[model samples]
Target: MVEPPMAEKDTATMKPVGTTDPVGITVVVPSYNQGRFIDETLRSLLDQDYPNLEILVMDGGSTDDTVERLRAYGDRIQWVSEKDDGQTDAIAKGFARATKPWITWLNSDDVQCDRALWRVAETVAADPAVEVVVGGAHYMDADGSNPRPYPTIDVGPGADVRREVFEKGYMAQPSIFFRRDLYERVGGLDRALNFCMDYDLWARFAASGARFGKVDADISGNRWYETTKTAGQTLDLYAEILATQHRIFGAVSPYFVQAVSDHLYGRFHSKFYGDRGHLFFRWLYFKALWTVINARAPWYCVKGLFCQTIAKSGPIAGDRMTFKDWRDGFKAFLRHGREVRP
Candidate 1:
């Protein structure tokens, strides 16, 4: 595997493009009615210690005070207010107007620290070969003081990078930066997808042989308490994302189908199956899981769902297991290292 780009560790003296600082980065913030938080978002970006940078805001026809807040920024941001598809579409439009080489986006409710841009710029400038640079991301609810560490993933160049991404989406959107070339190569964000567009874009990039670099520094502040669509319309958005994934990948794509199946079981089980799906429905759930896996890959399905059989024997009616049965079996295997041999 080729070595990924290395970023600067110390406060090295390097000249930034269009400035005497160090590096140039374009920060994009996409907003849709996040009125309460848009001011803070803009303030955070403007307060960045990085000297040479452009902040762009793309609004998707927000009806509330979001447009007013954006207007307050005036020429500070290369601002564009218009009707667009959704968050992903708004981001794509912002990227089209980006003039800088390094790019990253923060949600309207999210805020980057004053030094976040400077830290990211230093990292990217340290290594010329690094195609993508990602840093640590933490969650902030309302205020900026409290922080909760979020998972940060780095997919460096390798033969298995695509396989890993296709199997599991490991990176978060807010904590990422990469070259405009890489974005263009991966075909930018999918405008049709309201949510999970970032997932699809990352998968496409990884599949196309782009290398990822990691910085131990924190570069993003994610706000989880916002009324984001992922919080209100998870199931529907996931369904749309799954359909899009099938079209982009194939019907049998492991990542696409497995995620959809897991989500279906998760949402339904939590809503109805007993305390978490109903005892009777549990058996049907496993049977349905078996059916799905079998339809996708028979041998693989049988091997993976074998545990469902033992955990659902009490409420078993047919040749399948219930939701609780499958849950218990999976839990046992995960916690006790006990596998159901079939």
Candidate 2:
């Protein structure tokens, strides 16, 4: 691993200040055919002004202008554009080359918030024993507008981080950083997984008894566009997540079962009813009834489905919502015969 450049000096005393000997962080950006958005993503990291930063862009031989844009960065970043298996493969390759003490990956379409690296470094520096650091992030639209805070929960000491992640599915991938040693100890990412690989890594970290720390401030922006891999594949994503959980924990959680059922209904509703019309209510009711009749834990599944429905129908903006707000949103969904904004 290459050493990061030394910190800049203060004008008055000409002595290094701020992050003079900050912990190094390597950001691996796995990309392919993301020419339109890669530049902004790179700039976000470059502008962090964090001295101890290393960036690696592993491109899967993008046919777009992504290579040209990468060339523009010159030596500021290390990159390899070649044919690879997939996103997971590219990220695994980058991870293998990561030389920094700490490591994380930011997707080609995502951007790091201002000073995010600094904040992460400071948090890790404050507690050198912390093996993982999780922060907040926002869900941005395709055009980078309409930013909404992604759901985040505090995973303090002694907290069941793995259970919270499996049940709530709230950890933002880009907002997470971990020690390279922990990654090595956990055997890094599973190259076979197409989706939910990040979730799998978190599960491994927690199961291994890794110490976790949280940063309350938003540290990344995760773009959610129609063409993205996770956009219309809710059912598949959750399925993979559940599979990973089953493989790791030897049993899948009820929360994930409820999630699968809800998304199953969503897939059916979107395909047949276009997600609107009076048929929406009928489909939802039928799905609930089907769950009650067919599910293993019928009552728990029904209750979880009910709670998720109300929660998903809550106000479109804001990170948190009250129960009353969720109930009103559900009422609005019932009245309008469509899914409410969330």
Considering every candidate listed, which one attains the maximal lDDT?
A: 2
Residues 217-317 of candidate 1: C-alpha lDDT, one tens digit per residue: 66678776556567777677657755654555443333434444555655766455324323334444545655664455566655555543423332212
Candidate 2 lDDT tens digits, 149-172: 898756876778876765565689
The true-versus-predicted C-alpha distance at residue 195 of model 1, in Å, is 0.7
Minimal lDDT window, size 10, model 2: 309-318
- Residue 221, model 2, lDDT: 94
* lDDT (C-alpha, whole model) for all candidates: 0.66, 0.77
TM-scores, one per candidate: 0.73, 0.78
Model 1 off-target regions past 4 Å?
A: 1-21, 142-146, 154-160, 244-273, 276-287, 293-342
Error of 1 at 71 (Å): 3.2
Per-candidate clashes, comma-separated: 9, 0
Model 2, C-alpha of 112: deviation from truth (Å):
0.2
